[model samples]
Target: MPNEPTASLSPRRLTTLGHSCVLLELAAADGSVRRLILDPGNLTAPLTATVAVDAVLITHPHPDHVDPSQLAALAAGRELPIFGGAGLGSYLSEAGIDAVTELEPGEHEIAGIQVRVGSAPHEVIHPALPLPANLTYEIGGVFAPGDAFARPEGQTEVLLAPTGAPWMKLLETISYVAEVAPQRMVPVHDGGLGPAHRTLHTTVMKKFAPEGTEVSVLAPGQSLEF
Candidate 1:
């Protein structure tokens, strides 16, 4: 089957902010944009991207993905709905956020976009500790994995995947792409890693994908629109 037209897709653009952060800018068909922050690391092109985030989505309450100060700044200025698991919602409240929503692994509609929170765990966090519930989201057929194996499912036109710490194994990563069936996949989650670690990630993604999947590995400040 042919791909869905852009008009069918909610007016949304995915920008890779730093680390596991992704700026999801969703606009109404009329052109009003709703901004959502997924993970709170230093985002790429902050001056341009940060201005648009109206809602913030934090996958986990970790230091890298959840910055209390940033959330405070947004809450003080605007009424932003912060979405995450139950624990993360509590963490945001203590930080003074008024609008917060707790999401489990299921399906829902937000801002006219279909959001599916899939089951994922921090595979590499630790051996014995109870890893927080990790999430992978599907918005307008684009998969934005918080920090887990992003196996893009059927008809996924774009994929914003991770390539740094909290990443899946190399072979697993390849399998993820194979499953997603997206037209384009961009690598993210390198903002906090060192030069060598970043290099290794790039090399692995370049070598591991099946023949058909196209990987657009971007730097911090770059943008990819599907």
Candidate 2:
């Protein structure tokens, strides 16, 4: 059988900072580069301090997705722009942090990078509990869908897939990959799993991923250039 054609991966650089946090760097036409941090809620040292972020993008207001102290420390003296969903903006403001821009589902340009926002319902964990709004972000060719199994507007060169969460299942995750059909898929939202479970999830995902799609699980502080 002929090999299936794979989707093209983005030329941008992606670095995983543990959990769902990612650092994305894209080269501009003038040889300059822009660096943006997404969901910097659980990043460890060294990686957290070394990354020179131009802006921060938060997908939701969950504590695991928005560590206020970490963000405050990161933006201590710098004029770092923080963008988040509507609910997140209110949460930050209530906490006395007013540096966040409320972004709805649309296209926006931030820190010289094109960002497209897509709305996706946060998986329901319980009937009584109110689910927070979730937003999926497509920055350049990298798509990070916060806590939702959402499909962005256009082609996804690199997809940050949530593998393990209270609101997700293995089968649903597999289905999401098939639906998005990206060239590359990386596992995120898996901080709660142990090493063995994490490895197992990665192995199973790689085995069942759609043809032409590459699934990679990065260790904390690891980076991959596509």
Candidate 3:
């Protein structure tokens, strides 16, 4: 059960880059740090330029979640793999991206990190709209369900809940958080929220989150260690 999440986890930093993108830096006992970028999209493109990343993770292939040109440029010759679900690998390949590693519902090692992909279908964006394959990323002491409300197996210390999206409401977010019941709930997918609205989300989520769960809101360019 070494890979299974524990009630308490070691220290790690989660840096919010607006929207779904974040820079996760995991520290090992030897003082070595591994950095990974999750959901590097249009909203976070500017910030990612200067940061060092060992790998890129895509939750889905939406333009907001995955920018082909940006990803192509980022992975130019670093030989870093873009870890994602089967669909993402195909999407990246068709987009002419190299070093694509498609994953399924299971645990795998990437860049010396234990990454897990959950088996869950994405929430309905719209009946008229097509839902591409979405990958849930469980790594670096945090669980990111891409664009879905699905939870990962075992316990997780932190959950990167999607708090802002046109496809969901406040109630759904609260319920999903309650269901997962993680020790910490950090709002992601919030690029669309303005100052007041962003504040509102933090306030409301804090109000209704499970008793043991704490809501931490990290705005663009903000970093929090947990």
How should the candidates be ordered by TM-score, best one leading?
2, 3, 1
What lDDT tens digits, residue by residue, belong to model 2 across residues 42-74?
533323345567788988888778887778766
Q: Model 3 misses residue 131 by how many Å?
A: 0.5
Local lDDT at 189 for model 3: 88
Query: TM per model?
Result: 0.81, 0.90, 0.87
* Best of the candidates, TM-score: 2
TM-score of 1: 0.81
Indicate which candidate wins on lDDT.
2
lDDT tens string, model 3, 39-107? Answer: 878766454245557788888888778777667555655666787766776777787676777778787
Candidate 2's TM-score reads 0.90
Residue 88 CA displacement from its true place in model 1, Å = 1.2
How far residue 139's Cα lies from its native spot in candidate 1, in Å, is 0.6
Q: Clashing residue pairs in candidate 2, if any? A: none
Off by over 4 Å in 3: 1-11, 28-31
**lDDT per model vs. reference:** 0.67, 0.80, 0.78
Worst 10 residues of 3 by lDDT: 1-10
